[model samples]
Target: MTTWLITAEETVIADGAAPHRQIEIIRKVHGNKTREEALVELHKAAKSHVPDSLKGTSRVVGRDSDGSCWILPKNGKGHPPCVIRFVEQIHP
Candidate 1:
C-alpha cells in the first residue's frame, strides 16, 4: 500500500473573491502505481471528503505532477475560479 499525504491548503487571493483551497498529493511514497494512478485516487477522495467547515468554499479538484492546482464550484466544470500553484515540493 502507498502512503500518501493529501493536503488542503486555504489561501486568500488578491482578486477579492472568496477564499480558496487546493488539494494535492503533497507526499506520496511506497506505492507501485504510476504517478497518474496515485493522483486519480487522490482526486476521487478529495471530491467527496472535504471537512464540513471547509466544504462551503474549497473546491480542489485537479493536480499535475508538477503540483499546479485548480478549484471550482461543486457540480460545476471548466475554468477554475483560481489557481493554487505549488510553492515547493519537499522530499524529506
Candidate 2:
C-alpha cells in the first residue's frame, strides 16, 4: 500500500490568520504513487465528506519534502480527516 501524510488547519475568515490547530495523519492506500496522483484521489475522496457549503472552497495546501501533498479545506471551518490521503500513481 502507498503511504500518505495528512495535516489539518483551522483558520479565521475575517482576517485570514494562522490556523488554530494543525493535525496530522498517516494513511496507506492501494500502492505506490506520485504526489500529484495522490492529491487527485484525496480531493475526490474529500469531496464527498465536505459540507455542501464548503465544497467549492476546498483546496490542496502544500507538498512535503518527500513529495506527499498536504490537503486542506479552505474558506470555512471544521473539516474532517484533516490530513493527507494516499492513492496509486496513474501518470507521470
Top candidate by lDDT: 1
> Per-residue lDDT for 1-92 in model 2, tens only?
45554333333233467445443333334456666776766655444344322456755455556644444656445553244444343344
Q: After aligning candidate 1 to the native by TM-score, how far in Å is the CA of 47 from where it should be? A: 1.1
Report, for all candidates in order, the number of backbone clashes: 0, 3
lDDT of 2: 0.47
RMSD of each: 6.6, 8.8
Q: Candidate 1: worst 10 consecutive residues by lDDT? A: 79-88
Listed in order, each prediction's TM-score against the native is 0.39, 0.35
Model 2 stretches astray by more than 4 angstroms: 11-19, 24-27, 51-92
Task: Write candidate 1's Cα lDDT for 1-92 as tens digits.
Answer: 44555554544343668756644444443456665665665565555554433456635556666654545555564333433342223455
lDDT of model number 1: 0.50
